[model samples]
Target: MTQPIFKDMLVLELASVLAGPSVGQFFAELGARVLKVENAATHGDVTRSWKLKAEPADTDTSAYFCAANWGKASLALNLTEPEQLQQLYTLVAQADVVIASYKPGDAERLQVNYEVLQCINPRLIYGHITGYGPDDARAGYDAVVQAESGFMYLNGDPGGEPLKMPVALMDILTAHQLKEGLLVALLQRERTGQGQLVQVSLLQAAVSALANQATNYLVAGQEPQRMGSEHPNIVPYGSVYTCRCGGKLVLAIGDDRQFRKLCAILGAESIAIDPKYKTNYERVQHRQELNQMLHQLIAQQDRGPLLQQLHAQHVPVGAVYTIPEVFAQPQARQLLLQHPGSKPGLRQVAFRLQGQQELDLSPPPTYDNYLS
Candidate 1:
């Protein structure tokens, strides 16, 4: 069997919570040896205590903590203690990369900043995540960053209260951005024999992911408002319809041809050729009317049959699934990783490479499992 891409890499995770740990997990999933250092004074990562009401209070690990912490060994240390801090320095001297999520000044305060670590290992890539940026002192939280980055402003139903996404979207986005930056830094190191710091903030990452919505405001002078699952530019796209079977489905008719196909399946062939909804632009202008017609037609059909027909005809339609329903699909099941004693978790690395095989990764570690 072929070896994984990062088989010889060593990642030292000095970060807690989602973003930084997730980046570490990405490397871990690619076969890097990741060692996560947690605070002994605080009994490790704060997420270890972030449990659901149903979770056992006595355990050190929580479902939230396990989310981004698979395939790693854990070392608990008090950085304030010289002996413990020295151990970290020893590890830093040998690590290829260090992932940190310290606030603006905390890393410097702990003497683990890039400047200090660089002196220890010149080829070490340091990836840092913050709530805002290096200039900002406020602690970064995902929900707050979502609000500051304009995501909360543009999410949710029109005229309703702004809602943060169900997941830590800002943290997740920051992780992906940091991962890309770190990968580039590694490549640069290959060329120059030197590593540099890669920094990403949750706020900036969220703003960068705005994509077309930001352009709608910047180029067109149209400030986006909450439309609740509806895309501003495309009609019949992102609109959810409830069927007679009480199941909800969403449509993403990108082109006029697909729109026509969708209308034909709904038994509204006349609407497919209608001038008002013939093209996407015209349909956008008459979104309410077009959507109302489609809603009525869809409400009369069974969801399973309608979805099957849409799939067979190449119309982009999907059932709106709950979390459990999502995992019930075979495709979703294939992404799962089940350790011997822990609950199954999703693999962070989703992309496939040639001749890649399934990884046998260790479970998320218990506190200071490496010490034990």
Candidate 2:
């Protein structure tokens, strides 16, 4: 088979934590030559020891570090040194893309901003991932960005204070947006023969990811609420119960037709046609009552059988899966999501070769190897 795209693209990754490196990893998977640039004295990336405490050299064993640094080469240098800075400039001259996830003022202070790099390579696609906007000086983390961007307000339980999403969603979203911005910059460079700064902020990404929610609030003056796995305006479109062998199965009914089918399958046709539950709006209003009724009826169902029956009905229903359960799932197996390998000293995740002939699953580099 032919090699994947970007086999010749050289990417310089100067990102830490999630935002910058996540984007670099995606590119690395597509056959880009990605070099993770970090400072020699400091920890290579904050995620190195993000989970459990470990010795300085043991970071390669961290799943947190493995997630972002896979399929890339690591190079450490102290830019404060004139020689190292010149080396980086030389790298920039050769690179097709440069990504940095630094504090707001760090780039300008270091004199490694896009403008400086552009002087070295006019065609370089420079991407910056920040916590806040280019002008904001506030310390931006995922939580802070989520709150500032109005995304936190839409999460969590109803009537509760605004809560941020459980994961580093802002950073992750920013990473993807950075990838998109890089692609756009590449296209623009192709036309104008000039490189440009592509900046993506976590706050901006959070707002962008809100999609229809943001529009609805702006147009209808309806502050989005925390529905807790339930749709805000759709009824019978949320969680339901089905009884089978001994336990209950949660069913999700998205439309009136699906609800009608569910009712038929459960032999509860009256509930589907009842005037109080006839319309989607009416069903939404009486969600509590409906849930209660379905919960009672579904208490005797087995989860396995309910899932099979629902799949046959073509209803978009599913049981909530745990993290480990998802990895063990048959569909996940088909996708080849699991990486199997050993780190030199400690075990680390191997990058799965997605129908590709070559696999780059080397463990995070050591201090000496990182500096090279």
Candidate 1 per-residue lDDT, tens place, 1-372, comes to 689889989999999999999999999999999999999999999999999999999977799998999999999999999999999999999999999999999999999999999999999999999988999999999989889999998889999999999999999999999999999999999999998999999999999999999999999999999999999999988999999999999999999999888888888899989999999999999999989999999999999999999999999999999999999999899889898877898888888999877678888988858653
Model 1 stretches with alpha carbons more than 4 Å out: none
Candidate whose lDDT is highest = 1
Q: What is the lDDT of residue 21 in candidate 2?
A: 80
Assess candidate 2 and give its lDDT. Answer: 0.75
Per-model TM against the reference: 0.98, 0.89
**lDDT for predicted candidate 1 compared with the true structure:** 0.93
The TM-score that candidate 1 achieves is 0.98
Q: What is the C-alpha lDDT profile of model 2 across 255-358, one tens digit per residue?
A: 78888877776678999899878778788778899878777656656778767877898967777666677667865654332345643221122345566654
Which residue pairs does candidate 2 place in steric collision? 243-301, 244-301, 245-302, 247-301
